[model samples]
Target: MAGNKQIIIAIDKDGYVKAEVSGVPGPDCKKYLSLIEEIVNGKATDETLTAEYYQQSTSSQNDQTSLNQQNG
Candidate 1:
């Protein structure tokens, strides 16, 4: 798969937890992050978007285009 994804989780000495998602494209990455949030039982206080976060896969783009054409 072109968009092979991973989530990295870490905990500090004070017990603060952090998670980072990589290799996922577009808004779909949030689903993985949300799963991490549930495991940590906390809301995100900050976020950093990577290049992949802003990149949409060709399949997703085509799906969106098809929907727009159908609705329009």
Candidate 2:
């Protein structure tokens, strides 16, 4: 699980839903989109990935090690 996940949702006067996710690193934010879709019973027609989407999670970063370590 990512740290401090947050989802901000807004609906326009025309009933168009827009959702933004924060505090979640990497593609993990997509999970929240599914949750939002289930709640609203609607599918997302567009998506914009933020900088956080390209960032590695803390856990994944910590799990990586130099190849030299494998020979030890």
Candidate number achieving the greatest lDDT relative to the actual structure: 2
lDDT of 2 at 12: 64
Query: Against the true structure, what is each candidate's TM-score?
Result: 0.64, 0.68
Model 1: clashing residue pairs?
none
User: What are the clash counts of all predictions, listed in order?
Assistant: 0, 0
Candidate 1 ranges beyond 4 A from true positions: 56-72
User: What ranges in model 2 sit over 4 Å off?
Assistant: 59-72
lDDT of 2 at 5: 60
Give the range where candidate 2 is weakest over 10 consecutive residues by summed lDDT.
61-70
